[model samples]
Target: MNKIQQFWSDFCIVTHKEGIEYKDAFQFGTSADWLADLVVEGKKTATTSGYMFYEFENEAIPQTGEYYIVLNGLEEPVAVIQIQSVEVIPMNEVTEEFALAEGEGDYQFWWNAHEKFFTELLKEYDKEFSPNMLVVCERFKKVYSK
Candidate 1:
């Protein structure tokens, strides 16, 4: 396989621990929606609750670290744990041809992958408890690199 194809394959392996079936397409919005829906449903029992999305900016990709997702219940903030590393594959790997072939199955794969990624990251970080958190894949692009 070419570099791009190899990278794509590796990325899929990392994202989908169970192994990708070549039909999965990573759906971005669905994961966010899933978290939002969870919060909305949880609020009925917990009373006031909400979630916010934060974006990270830097010349290089960030390493996994603690991020805050402010909640009405807490005076401080709810932590959304992350594991950032340089292994991030470029966005171009998800080309039109690949996406078309993968179809909607990729979104399902991503949703499941995000869940596993966050769960595993939390374990690696040694977080005692799982909070209402959503793990996001931040695709970092360099200004000069093509």
Candidate 2:
């Protein structure tokens, strides 16, 4: 197995041995390595993504109480986080409080960055950017780190 595969294998073994339940594995931003570091440091506690992307990718919405293995930019396992809550809201409805939970920067910065990120992603599907686009807002707490 490759290094990434081995990491997950080891993690599964350890978690199972300790009787911890994990639901799935995923990485942070496409190129944002710092965000993963923030998660490891227990700074970033929430994330948001385009709801359509999840549908397009055929991925399940994260559930409360589900444990997720967080990977870094290098696709290396960095930390484990448990989902606390998930809400689906329009992009324009995203609030300052939720932006603060992202731990990237101030509210405006988060808004701008996420808008750009989602805009680009939607382009692949020939979708136009819409201020009212649906987004999945997930709140999580770090449970373990490497």
TM-score of 1: 0.23
Each prediction's Cα lDDT score? Answer: 0.30, 0.85
Cα error, candidate 2, residue 132 (Å): 0.8
lDDT score, residue 120, model 1? 61
RMSD of each: 18.6, 2.3
Per-residue CA lDDT of candidate 2, range 1-146, in tens?
96655655676776673555567667888655798899988889999999998899998889899888888877778887889999999999999999899999999999998989988988999998898999999999987776
List ranges where model 1 is wrong by over 4 Å. Answer: 1-105, 128-131, 136-146
Top candidate when judged by lDDT against the true structure: 2
lDDT of 2: 0.85
lDDT of 1 by residue, 1-146 (tens): 74334544554455452342222112123344443333333321111111112222222323434221312232222212222222222322333333232233354453454345545644654542233442223321111101
When summed lDDT is taken over every stretch of 10 residues in candidate 1, the lowest stretch is 44-53
